[model samples]
Target: MKNTILLLTLLFSVNAFADHSTSKFVWSGKCLNSNCTRSEIEAENKANYQKHLQHIQDLDAEQEEEDREWSRQHDEDQARADALPKYQYKPIPETDNCVTRFYEKASSIIGDNAKEYIDVEEIKSGKCIFGFKLMAEEMCEYFDSFSSMATPDWSEAEWCRYRSELREVYIQYSGLVGTSAFTDAVQAERKAKLKPVEDKHHKIYQNLYEQHLKQLKQ
Candidate 1:
């Protein structure tokens, strides 16, 4: 009887130990070891979130800087273009035939070869004269002739504005091409005022040419 009682006691003890072990895991879901801590997981997630936010902010800053730089460059380009000369045409009688003659003369000079380079400096000279002279004449013809035919309702202010604009264009390109002379004869006639103007524009044109040459060599 004592032996059977001892055996029954041993079995009860084993079952009680198993029930106690399983009872410890009752769905509380808390980590039961030193390997994983709630605080450590929270810290890791917060750090990752902060890092991602910083990365997004950096990208936004870069894009804003790029946009600002593009705006600055675009404004600078617009300013340079605005500084270029314009043209203004005036009313003149029977200027059509004279314009045609100028065109014929100027068109024959501008070329696409080594001669163009050689002639670039001499463009205002008789050898390079016709190209730009004709260009000016044709422009005047179209603006003046067309305006007279279709726009009798045009105001004096409008005409003046047109003439001023056209003159500016002529001056700018004349500066560019140095095409002020009709011929040596015409040059001699206007040498007093023409020379100083040409001299000034020539300096600017030469500087631009030198810069272009430097870029090409580079």
Candidate 2:
């Protein structure tokens, strides 16, 4: 009877061991260590939670720094753009000047008269003036007539420009076919025609140039 009781006691003890070993402990709502007690599992979970919270805080700090750097760069770019210079255009303004008066007088003297200056070759080849000496004489007369149209009221600049254009034509036909007499006669006529008013108007325009510059500044 004592031997049977001992056998029953041994079987009961083994069954209790099996039940204790098989029982599970859950951590963070999931099954965890089989060997760990409840207190040890809770301590491990608290440490894990703290580490996860620290990682999240570190990520947030990094993101905040990046945002601050981006904002600083954007503000610098805007300030640079604002610092650049700006420009605008304006039209030329008209003035009541002596130059205007000269133009007005010149327009009346130079109308739709297209054939103002005579062509030397046209006169020579067309049997109008046959020989070289006769053609040269006719050319000189034509130059004189063209020059007489300019009045004493014209500016020095206008006169100089006209004289330069006429001198270029004289150069083209200087001396090949007995044209020296013609060019010399043309020069003498031009000097006589211009000398009287040129002395007066030349200084006037020079002074006017300075006056116009002052007006522009104002």
Top-lDDT candidate index: 2
Question: What lDDT tens digits, residue by residue, belong to model 2 across residues 95-210?
Answer: 53433332344335544222232221222222221111212332332333334433222233344444555565556556643645656767676566567555555666777678
TM-scores of the candidates are 0.26, 0.29
Q: Per-residue CA lDDT of candidate 1, range 96-121, in tens? A: 44333444333343322322221122
> What is each predicted model's overall lDDT from 0 to 1?
0.44, 0.47
Worst 10 residues of 1 by lDDT: 114-123
Over 4 Å off in model 2, which ranges? 1-34, 87-218
Instruction: Return the top candidate by TM-score.
Output: 2
Cα displacement (Å) at residue 158, model 2: 25
Candidate 1, TM-score vs. the true structure?
Answer: 0.26
Number of clashing pairs per prediction, in order = 15, 0
- Native-to-model Cα distance after best TM-score fit, residue 216 in candidate 1, in Å: 57
